[model samples]
Target: MKDLIFDNFQNAVDESLLRHKSILDIITKLQESEGRINRAVAKSVTNCGCIRVDAKKQELPKEDDDIEQLSNALKTHIEGKLCDSCREVIEHEIGNNLFYLTSLCNALDLNLYDIFIKEYDKINTLGRYTLR
Candidate 1:
């Protein structure tokens, strides 16, 4: 019975990992497309009565290192047991990030609302409870 329970637990973990991997793949594609879309919008906006505003892009110390660093930081925070203040900060930051993403999608002519609804539907179909 112990072995059976362990196998079931392992299977659940594997399934969750696969789902995460699939989501990552989708996000990667979206990120790649964002660059192209941004360039195209930059070109087209000049004649479309839209103001072309250029903001200075911030450069990181190490390019493409943010994800790993963030993952490590989050792991450390979780392992160390996050304080209420830290949790609040994290939650706020997540909201900020989501807002930024939605703004970017709008600027890029992407239907963020539709995309969000589709993803939400997928999650809803997975037998998870969501606040209405």
Candidate 2:
């Protein structure tokens, strides 16, 4: 057996670290943007009592099995309530964000859940509070 070593190994590791940091920065920006979007959506839906009425009509299941069905129904109702332009804009922004996120994950050989956990830990360590 022969021992083989690459001269640029340090450079490769440093580059990977840089990429990881960049990904983290992107995640932070995305988190902030998501908070803003959520606030705006909540404000917009405040006056629309129909969502509450519909939600109240449904008999929410106690078991976890029907959670997905309930989630889909709520999402559909919210989308229906959004104006066409608002819906299109929201969908487009989400699609673009996901595209970049997946691409970064692929390049870094990481999954979204892992990245989210890492970011969450970082935030907690920094004494920041996260909603989730």
Candidate 3:
């Protein structure tokens, strides 16, 4: 059922994508979409003032601390949540990123769902060790 959704999205992208059909075009567009996402987030912080980023060097857990403690010690440095307008813009940009990502997979004759499953299986099998 989940695979069906991913397959349909890939098919939709393949069918609707007419201008940027070339692999090179798709790759560059994919890169552009990533930048757009970053810009949207930045706008939310700078323009909308809905969120604030207070990023700094991360402090590590004690040497004797467990993996769970390390996880708990980490921070995203983002305060508050995205407002509706900022959230919508970010979601749209991310969708564009996925479209090009699927296009790249299509051009390379790869199954997007299979790639997802492979990653999922690897993470599931590796658990916390997958971080490395």
Task: Say which candidate scores most in lDDT.
Answer: 3
Candidate 1: residue 91 lDDT (0-100): 61
Query: lDDT for each of the candidates?
Result: 0.47, 0.51, 0.95
Candidate 1 local accuracy as lDDT? 0.47
Clash statistics: count for each candidate: 0, 0, 0
Badly placed stretches (over 4 Å) of model 3 are none
Write down the worst ten-residue block by lDDT for model 2: 1-10
Which numbered prediction scores highest in TM-score against the true structure?
3
Report the candidate with higher TM-score, 1 versus 3: 3
How many clashes in candidate 3? 0
| Predicted candidate 3 versus true structure: per-residue lDDT over 25-48, tens digit per residue | 999999999999999999999999
Candidate 3 residue 22 Cα shift, in angstroms, is 0.8
Prediction RMSDs, each to the true structure: 19.3, 12.3, 0.9
Model 3: how far residue 62 lies from native, Å: 1.5
lDDT of 2 by residue, 2-31 (tens): 111221332343354443457766576457
Ranking by TM-score: 3, 2, 1
lDDT of 3: 0.95
